[model samples]
Target: MTRALSAFLVLFGLIAPALAAPQNKDGDSAEAIDLLTQASKAVRRETYRGIIVYLRQGDVDTLKVVHRYYDHEEQERLISMSGQVREVIRKGDKVTSILPDHELVLVSEHPPKSMLGGMSHFSPKRLKANYQVVDLGTARTAGRDCRVIAIRPRDKFRYGYKMLIDSKTQLPLKLNLLHHGKRLEQMMFTDIAFPDHIPDSEFVPSYDVHGFRIVRHQAVHVSESASDKREEQWHATNLPPGFKLAEDGVRQLTSDASVRQMLFTDGVATVSAFIAPAGLRAPLKGATRMGAVHAYGDIVDDTQITVVGEVPAITARRIAQNLVQEKNTAKKAPAAND
Candidate 1:
């Protein structure tokens, strides 16, 4: 029975490795989640200053930002190197978009939905549903130990991404848009630091110009209705991995006089489609690719459909081409009175 005992031991050894793998995976996942949670909280709590660069197809500009936060209130000052110095101070959803050129501050209620806000959307639970997040070892960035996580899309309706988060603070040090396993776009922190004390005066605007124009814009609200729900009657039979119907509405565009608006999101990225009745001008044909943004215009019957998104070119084209209108009535339907 010695041979039998040896065979049993071999089987046990093989099973042990398999059993241990799941526990290891669980541990890694928990650590990643913890990092993400802490980073989200840190962004809202910490105050500092640094230089940030926005890179896209046609435009490249570096800007300096100084932010101060206290009592759940934040004041931010932004200076553009290429253009005039502009300052924006935001308290909650209300923001003042300052323009030094006109010496005016335009008030708006949106958060500018910037790269910082985009990073804020990286919630561990919401992201886990659409992406398979795994730590791809570790590396040093900006003098910090960064744990790299590859967010692989589960479907073709969306693209994939990779993010590097600081091991100690959990803040994202780098973000990359992946295409076919390669980076199509990337945002990396050239230099970063967390300071304990930020001067309050730095948060205030620098210039004072008399007789400046102050333009205040109102916030647009989205409502749920049959017309809004059936705005384009659009359904994408094929989409890149991870995309879903994020929003839809009816609105008029300058190019087209008709009212139509549709929004789609793949959690991380979003695309807005606007359709309307064609103007008196002839139908236009062509496509334009602008950095991360792609715009496509086509005529569906007499309706002009335009699709814009920060996704790839092909994705924008496919979505614009698939625009359709659904009829409201069936053949010989009974009247409500009957």
Candidate 2:
């Protein structure tokens, strides 16, 4: 799991905590649930277009997004307006990302709904069990009256979330990612409008004068034995509250033989951990900040593991230290105490 959340924040351009306000009182409010439920529904049923800016440490990116929601069909197109020329188009379970100079396109098959799309996750009750949702009063965004809902992390491993949802339609107007009292990063619809129609041609791919090349590649493979087997049996004893294993596997980079990865999420935030053997060719030990996302690496137990996510340095450090590779046995297994 290469800092799962950090890479995702860069790739998807959604998710983050920005600008902090004081914590809200804890409660199970019919009003809060009703407000959040409405916002989730609105994101699914409405068609909108807007610009989203992703800010991390020193990097800032603006992406123009066009979205359409009808029936069971949801389509989105994202074009990078700064930095490198990158584009991503998604339809339901399929996503294709195109890189200009690299002349490569990567495709992923996903569940119909993902956290980035503002879709529901697991059961609302499961999330409420670990997070305390509270009403943080109101704010004005893009001329819309918005109600703020704060999700306070009940434990240390995970950060907190505050959202400004449209009061009229219950749609998310802005989202803030918070760690310990400070706003790490944020994403909001600086300007948004519910459009009546979006032409199908808008979703088509764009090509330049030199044309392009396609590289069809399969998913990265990890050997079940030998040197690569270490990652397959790795486990963690300490994790932030509300976070659970979401996805895991190996993804081959263009330059590597294979890279093993593990993904965890708390419905909204995702963190990826990547493991490779330590050697002259392994990744370095250091931390890099991009807007609200943090990428950090260290050599642990002779294995080079890099933990990156939209989380605080302390959270990432604790997660890195808690990784334990237990020995296997044929008998009943005993659970490790935290």
Candidate 3:
């Protein structure tokens, strides 16, 4: 896949899953949940500037970020301080990615979510059912005292996380993505400052883009007739325990092609399945990994199925294998709501 397509898939497929929470038996469940709750809120409510280091697949990239919350909305800017010169600016649901190296700009509507720094707001009752939350004592990051908390998966289907939350602001100063007790990705802030005010100009793009190619991704609208037909054509036969289909729809990928997307979540971890015509492009027939994200692809009934998530390889492979085209006209269960 091209770099732009890979980035789009990561945004729409991998990072878009919702989380469900359960109770923890290993540590103080109430304290763990409360701390997580606070950290989640701080990510959205606090306005700060920081320098963050991201480590993935033995590669490190640094970023400078400025975020502000005003009028109940979020405005943030992130600029790469290493490797390629790229920038991401978000104002609420609209996100613009600037690639200086490619002279390209991608604009899309994305929910405010993060795989590295932000915490998903989840139900404690639901979260406790799938994972064990524990207080792992104290640690220090960015010269500030922090509380270490671990959210370990109850099974091997999903990944786990270790977070260092700032003692005063409740912001996450460090985060580690774990799989099978091994670190897959890590992000930590080396310096951060909470500012009283961040001007609007701070969120503007730093690079000039007078001749850059801008690509806008708009939501596709399928008619009721087409939607009903698709509902009878494909469905997932088996879902992992605690997982449920959260969202499914047809998305326009090009003028002549569209793909059906299904999002599944077990409250904390999420996976996404995409189905398209086998001839849409070259089919991916195996597994691939990029840091904590795992993707599996296969062909079913001449249709292409690809599953991607921040879950284990087995989880993605199982999800892809279970997505089958219906041989009969039997109606399937509707997707669940978050």
Candidate 4:
């Protein structure tokens, strides 16, 4: 997939170890769960603006974000403060990205709840099975007193997260993505403000995109008949503990080609499995890692199988290796251009 398309899909899709602090014995787990639940709600229900620093691998970038929640709908705009000049505007599910360096614009539909910070609706009760939530005491971020919380993985199949939530507004001020006690990626707000009212003009792009090359990715929902057939044709026989199939459908990337996708999640972590016809491009064999995101690919029954997620490399490989394509269920579709 193109970088823009991958980003759009992945959005519709990490953290660090904690310092030595006294763990609360009483009400710690319950408090951590409550805090996380509040933070998730705050992300969608509050209007705020801030400067965020995003670090992945060894590179860093800065962004200015303006978010507004009104009438039960959310709108946000992010402008690059460092590196290439770019902007992203998200109103509900439709996302418009403006790349000034390339003079390109990408318009695509994504899940409305997907945020640039990667926080989404999650079930605290369900997450308990695979991750241990703990209150890591207090810390300060963005000049606000915050409560530190850690969601530690029970096994190596998944990663961990450390969050510093504003004590007053319950907004997440900093988030760290961790693997094996090492940091993979980190996003922290350098400055933030919760405003009483944010005008609509704040969400508009600052640059004129009238002459930029525009690419639109349309999502074609599968018919009921096709969806039933898809369920029978693809499945993962072996999945890690607590992981369940959350979404399954076929997405039309282009007019002539479609890809079958199945999304699996353990409440806190998610994995996506994609199946497209072979020869669309060179198949992505074996495994690869881009920061915290791991992808594994293989070929099955003349189809290309790629499993991608922000989980461990082994988790992606296991999911890719266990996919089973039923025989004679349906004919292969047209190849998708990656």
Candidate 5:
């Protein structure tokens, strides 16, 4: 599945240690959970606007974000403050990305919620099961006192997270993505304010509409097959522990019905498998690595299979090389009456 998370990862994305953290004598394990839960809830319950400094390697981006929820409806706008005039506006499930540099307006439908939207779907119980939740005391972020929490993974399948959560509001102020003891990406709020009310005009796109091309990605022609058939056609016999098949589907990208997709995740990390006719898309020769994201591709039985993820190159290659074309025995089997 090409999700909002993957789109975000394509531009910005990490792993951490597998060792468990030694907790302090006075700290309770559940306190970490409570703090994370509060942070998740605060995304929807509060209206805030801030300047976010996103850093990945030598690339740094200053983004201004305004997010609010009114009458059960959520709206958000993110604009690049440096470099190109790029912007992404989201209202509910509709996402509109305006790239002034490219002079193109791309529109697509995304999920109602995403990890970038402060994942409310993230389960603390699942996190505890897959990681070691550590409370690292307190610090100051965005001029507000914050409680520090570090969620380190127990295996190589997922990434680690360190967050400075606002003490009173329970909002995240500074977040770091770690991998193998190194920080790969960082998100910190320089200045932020939670308001009693946010204006609707803040969500509007003030970009020039004249002479710009608009592409409706939401209207893409995709013919879907049964989910069961998709599962039968593709199988990941070997997967990292704690990772599971989150979603799978077979869909025609255009006029052909050979394109298939499968999504796997360990809650913290996600990977995508795309299978299609060899001639349908550009064949990935060997492997490519960019920052934290990696992709590998190969041709099997005259079909192209590509695996992509924000993971180690070894992990990406392993997933790509292990693509197995399992026969759909369920659909081929004779009926009970037969």
Candidate 6:
């Protein structure tokens, strides 16, 4: 029932006309898609340092970001300059997060395919299936001229995006996540500097970690023997349209317990389902929404199933309730290709 979704439903009827011929619609679509395509690339390939103002649910924080690409690879470092001396470094599939305040370090390796999801190049054709690309004219952000663009979602299951892309560098100076035509989250660059060289030491953690506790998230490797059909537990039968299972695996959270995880995405929104022993997680207790995160839980048979995503609470609840114990294994979709 969001305004964006309502607008999208009406927009669908005009899609054919929009793409028809020499018209402003066609030009707008192409321009919006082109800008996003280039911005995604610039975010990963270009080396830059900036101060980003992040706001969500009325709270704001100023964070510093540094990204560099070399030898056909990309690396990033995030530093929280206000509250605590915390930093996160990403090098390919492995990410290291350090908390100087708590003397802890978290290391986790994501599915190599989804590791660079944010930086992946976008496909206009594929994107058009779920969103309406519109040009919102031009504006100024971070002291630079920007091409304002809005990506309105076609369904309530996903959120819309508004971006102010730098005209010169093709980078997003301000990005906002919207719902009901309201900004739910915003990330805007207040100051930026593109430097010639950002040393490797800037990415390294400088805090004293002599006695820090380390929590390593063991990687889940789906081996040939483990892929046998009978070993899988549950499958989702009522998944929302356009959503595909991107990855699924089993990981041992403790010496006595192991959990099954399934990841799904509909090009924009990502959802995760975690199944563990019945008592490990609280029973299905409706939906819990905090800011942009929506979570729901349920007890399926003897397993506790929790579904969480950035989408609406209804989406998370529907996904959680669709868990079935049938033996049919879920076929995962291939990684998105740009």
lDDT value, candidate 3, whole model: 0.72
Per-residue lDDT for 164-249 in model 1, tens only?
Answer: 77787665666666767866656555677778878777766676745788887644334344356554465443554445555555
Model 6 lDDT per residue over 1-338, tens place: 01111122122212222332221443446666666666656766678898877777887777788878877877878788765677888886677889988999889887645411332322234445666778899999889999998878877777887878889888677878898798897778899888988998888876877899999887765434335656455677667755667667778766777787788766656788888888775566678887887899876556788898778776787787776655523433321221
Best-first order by TM-score:
3, 4, 6, 5, 2, 1
User: CA shift at 18, candidate 5, in angstroms?
Assistant: 20
Query: lDDT tens string, model 5, 70-142?
Result: 7887678888888778888878768888998888998887553332222332343444567777789999988
The numbered model that scores best in lDDT is 4
User: Deviation in angstroms for 244 in model 5?
Assistant: 0.2
Model 2 misplaced regions, further than 4 Å? 1-26, 101-104, 111-126, 208-210, 215-232, 240-242, 252-257, 266-268, 279-282, 286-288, 300-302, 328-338
Prediction 5 TM-score vs. true: 0.81
Stretch of 10 with least lDDT, candidate 4: 11-20
lDDT of 5 at 298: 79
TM-score of each: 0.69, 0.74, 0.85, 0.84, 0.81, 0.83
Worst ten-residue run, lDDT, model 1? 1-10
lDDT of 3 by residue, 208-321 (tens): 999999999764333355476744456676677667666666777767667877777776677888888798888899899887889999875567889998888888887777
> In angstroms, how far off is 141's CA in candidate 1?
2.4
lDDT (10s digit) by residue, model 2, range 1-338: 11212233322222222111223344655576666656655665668788777665646677887778756787878888788888887787677778887877777664433323333323354455556777889999878899988877776656777878888777687777787768776667788888788889888877551456655444434345433565347666556656666555665554545566766666555677777767747466877666555666777556787777776665566555555555522222323323
For each candidate in the order shown, give its overall lDDT on alpha carbons: 0.56, 0.63, 0.72, 0.73, 0.67, 0.68
Badly placed stretches (over 4 Å) of model 4 are 1-28, 110-125, 228-232, 254-256, 328-338
Off by over 4 Å in 5: 1-28, 111-126, 219-232, 328-338
Worst 10 residues of 3 by lDDT: 1-10
After superposition, the stretches of candidate 3 with alpha carbons farther than 4 Å from their true spots are 1-28, 111-125, 220-223, 230-232, 328-338
lDDT of 4 by residue, 118-192 (tens): 333344445665777788999888899999988788888898888788999887878787899999988888999
List clashing residue pairs in candidate 6.
284-297
Model 3, TM vs. native: 0.85
